[model samples]
Target: MSLTHSVNMNWKLLIGVLAGLLIIGMFSGSSGQQSSSAGQQSQSRALEASNSVEWKKVDFLELELPANIQELRDQVKITSGKAKFFDQEIFYQTGAVPAGVSRSGRTVLLLHGAAFTSQTWIDKVPTLRTLAALGHGVIAIDLPGYGKSSQASVPDNGEFLARLIQSLAGKQPIVVSPSMSGSFIIPMLANPQYRDLISGWVPVAPVSTGLVASFSSQLLTPTLIVVGENDRSLGNRSKEDLKGLPNATLPQVLPGAGHPAYLDQPEMWHKLLHNFIIKVNQANSAQFMEA
Candidate 1:
């Protein structure tokens, strides 16, 4: 071959190799940029979840709960306290958020039925410990004239509850009101001033549900009305009355359970409570972001 022809051929090969490398570099740079952008978006979402990047990594639904009640009770550390409101000292048992877990930025208040007290929640069910283990502050309270609390009755149930909730759970607490506590909760639900203080409500066959049943359309607080399938009277009645609330969900019926449903179906009850609390916090976080 002629030298000139050979030189021309080598030049063509060099040009071809250079063109290929340039194309590869363009694609590599684009791919790298896309990866970086995706990472940034993920981080932004983490930050939006209550200012805690750790929350994005943790899924409350996947967290483990102890199968043994005694072991769980032992594993969780709880304390007792009394909050004075309106000349009445309310007795309560509280559990703090567990270690190494990001706080959900929410609290849970457990109120008992007439037959039960604050200890009933700890001994009969896994409400308090499960909530604490899942990174939420939890409190089980003995209403006035019950358990360790003073025998003096509350003059204004709604006002007393409002004070107690603010003093104990802070703003936006998820309240678990079972049986007779419904009288206190229903009144609070009807009052517009206390609406923002409570994040969510679990009315477990509470009494005096009829008071708000007619005006439930105006009550916008997120409510989860739960009852037992076997509890034909109060359970069904409470659901019927409170289900009309604007933001209320359908009655969550626990199968084969009775009036104090959580005692008979603790696992299912805890699962529902966990899911509701997480959803409430998520909604609040979203609202905060939008605002």
Candidate 2:
């Protein structure tokens, strides 16, 4: 072979190698662009899901409830007692339906905030009697370290709460948790087994909501997120974080109220609570009928 022929062969080989490298780079760039586009689309869908479900809009006006627990007590029968709860005496108030009225078989477990106790449901707002009047059994318990209930020696809030509910609340009670009690309720809610035990959840400007934010989409025990419009931090942040839940409703915000909004507007707050209870019962009934 001549030198000229050898040089021509080398040039042909070099051209082929360059063309192959160029083709590979093109495919790599296209793949990177496709991956980036897929990521953006996923993020966009998540954002849409977060924003699509609007909050349940109810007209709320901040008003002082008539200061008369006696009036409410006279209307419904309320009994106070303490039950033994695993080394702690758990004090509670039971507002039974008026003697003749048929029972709805629904029990509501009322848990208080850091600043309040079981009596806050009875004295401050007549919450127990008001709910009882609706034909549902309402029990307001003084959590350990607050009110009449003995302080818990155990460190696990979730275990303590689960045991209390199982021992006290008869079969899938609707739990009403407010403020600091979120520390207890949020942990309980994170467990799927415990979630099965609760029929419904009402979290009122609950703290520690961030703990569940990452997996809240799976925490689907029909939840009603209640908050005050004036509560700018925990309330709003929780609303945003929890709104992504598949079965959660948009938050119920009380106008001109702050943290622990129920105290600020008891009448409106009670009305909302009653409505939520009714909704939960109806849903349960429907499921039973379907089954």
Candidate 3:
């Protein structure tokens, strides 16, 4: 063969080899993109399944007004209900649907301090009636051993509360936990599964131990931390510890209030709760529209 023809044939072979490599690279890139898309879809489906788990309802006794609750009986009606969780009965109180306030699909789950029962919400803040009047569903529960709920050896109260929230609200409900109940809730925010099921949090003078520091950055839910002006230590700690939360509000310290600030300043607490609920709901609505 002529030298020039031989060199031309070599060049054609080199072009063909380069073309083959280009095709292989394109195919690999396409497969990688498909795999990434599949991964995202799987994650979305798993989250939806986690959020959609159904809870069974259990029988509950009628609430007989104790002397502590008798004074507010006429102003707001209360009903008792129970749900079974792992052979334990979880009792809860539901405030009556206030006249002219339509069910807004925005539910609030009230968890009280260690010393208080579900009645404390109504007795102290009248939160249930106030929330109901604002067109929200209100459920105040007696944590495992408190009030009428049966106690069990709960290994993880955070997981237990997450399940209780799922069962009670049938969707992501706004959680309002005061004092010791924060011990259970703040940790729950670390678990993505539990975190996905909650819409928002209102932690009032919560007992923040070491857990707050580790999981503060992992919090994805909208949070509001409220403390009393008198409870400076906890108020300052919460403000500093929870600064990592992406969607947290500036800590609100009620004027002239003590540890149980809600009891002393019910009106301010109610206003803040109402406003937070509205803000969260609006954000959720905007997200839904964007999606």
Q: Clash number for model 1?
A: 0
For residues 88-193, could you state the per-residue lDDT of candidate 2 as single tens digits? 7888889878765567888999998989999998778777887776678888988888888747455688888898889889988989998888988888877655
**Per-model TM-score on C-alpha atoms:** 0.75, 0.74, 0.73
Model 2 TM-score is: 0.74
- Candidate order by decreasing lDDT: 1, 2, 3
Task: Give the winner by TM-score: 2 or 3.
Answer: 2
lDDT of each: 0.78, 0.77, 0.72
TM-score of 3: 0.73
**Residue 4, candidate 2: alpha-carbon lDDT:** 100
Clashing residue pairs found in predicted model 3: none
* Model 3 Cα lDDT, one tens digit per residue, 1-291: 999999999999999999999999999999988865763554354333322311011111112212433243345567888887766888899987655546678889999888898989777668887776666888999888788874644668888888888788758789988888877787677665567677778888787645766765555566777889897776667666765565667677788988888888887787778667766676667556546
**Candidate 1 at residue 274, lDDT?**
76
Model 1 residue 144 CA deviation in Å: 0.5
User: In candidate 1, what are the lDDT values of residues 1-291, reduced to their tens digit?
Assistant: 999999999999999999999999999999988875764454343234433223223333453354544454456788998888888788899886655666777889899888989999788887788888777888999998788884758888998898888888877788999999988887876665565568778999999988986556556556777899999999988988887665666678899999999888888888778777776686677757775
Best by TM-score: 1
* Preferred candidate (TM-score higher): 1 or 2: 1
Model 1 residue 1 lDDT score: 100
TM-score of 1: 0.75
